[model samples]
Target: MTAVEETQQAEAEDFLVDKAKAVEVEVPDAPEEIGRSDYYTAKEVSMHNKPSDVWVSFLGNVYDLTSVVSSQSRELESDGSSLVFPLIKCAGTDISHWFDETTGDIKKYVDPIKNMMTYYIPQGRFVHVPPAEPVSDWDNSFEVPWWKDATLKVGKLSASTRSLRVKNVLTGHEHLMEVPCEETVGQIRARYLEYNAHAASYTWKALKPNEEKELVFQNLDMTLNLQDNGIADDQPTFEALGISSDFHTPVIHLYYDDDLTVA
Candidate 1:
């Protein structure tokens, strides 16, 4: 268990250290008033995937690791300009699972930071990270496994890590995107509304070829649905979403729902 400070450059191998005596630093207490969250969609996080400007998320907290991966900073890189495998590959995305599987613990990322809330300064702009979301489920629901020793976790390519091609039939908008496998149709719809502000102009419907089913946001049965067509969320990723062609991705049709009330 090696204790590498956030200011200290880390080797791919430093992460491999795992002895109970390794990390001896003390993190400060949680803030007196850490306040509420300010969420950022996955699309927003994906925009910062460069060494000059790297950003990554875990569950929902976002962090700017640019200096950690850049040419500066304590020489974290071998040549002093590039980051190691997986970490570099995971820029601009949620690395919750990867960190979990790798060290079999998640604190390696947090422990290095000393204070969990330091990454959220002057929120809603350069960095939109929030204090860890309030727990509504389990106490550790959002946590990476706790380790007695700072074990470097083994990494796994998350199923949600695959960016698929999607098209909005109403606007003829197409994009390559990555969505969490754990997300429900309803969750996806909420995310869609974040950017497509004109959604009400044409009632947008979410669909997947695997189920050939159209999803209506207010329809709890439809929105809460998690599987359909010929695939489930965890396997054959893109295919599970019914997307089989790069030239022709699944289309999310939009049309006015007649039953919707309007003033």
Candidate 2:
């Protein structure tokens, strides 16, 4: 080959090398969450609607009031008051409207009859709320109100939600579940337990793209979420590219473990 040709070839090779380096430099790994706070979805909170496992969200926070509901129910029954029924009726739901956003306390209004401030309990009075009029039988001394109690708070309410497809290979059943973006696989499984009582008797796996760029059923870490396990949502990218996000929803496959366990 001519000297000029050889020089041009070397220059072309150098250009390709520089381009590859630039591509690598432009792309970066997603940042890892630090001191990650626990978050729960509204659907998750709704699962425990009953008094035995009641949960409620208020002021963007989730609270597990199962024990409180049980104890309060008994106390109200013994006192011959049905105030606790209102709490049970509103379980597993958001009660933010019942509280004052600015003060983070129960809502109050000026009573027309009494001409004074009093709780505006349209849903009827529940635990910790004092009677509108003082009575001889009313208890004057009580601990902090349940709404202000921090111990009942389980986690923050999730700001975003995502869809997940869970398939049971054994029963040939496919179920779509809406879950919090911050929840782990273990928590998702707990949600699935409602559908299939023996959800724990199955080994959970997901169909994710491998190094070969082919989708395959891979073992999943129950402790981590789909994104943490390298299965990114990429919904925004899909939308920007004129591709539907629903087309790329990940599917989780469940294989029976044959543990013979009953829920």
Q: Rate the local accuracy (lDDT) of all candidates.
A: 0.43, 0.80
Clashes of 1: 11
Expressed as tens digits, the lDDT of each residue in 45-159 for candidate 2 is 8888886888899999998877777776755523576767887898889999999999999999999888999999999888888888776666646578888889988999987
Cα misplacement distance, residue 71 of candidate 1 (Å): 15
Q: How big is the positional error of residue 34 in model 1, measured in Å on the Cα after superposition?
A: 23
**RMSD to the hidden true structure, all candidates:** 29.7, 14.3
TM-score of 1: 0.35
In candidate 1, where is summed lDDT lowest over 10 consecutive residues? 121-130
Per-residue error for 89 in candidate 1, Å, reads: 10
Which runs in model 2 stand beyond 4 Å of their true positions? 1-37, 74-80, 166-177, 183-263
Q: What TM-score does each of the candidates earn?
A: 0.35, 0.56
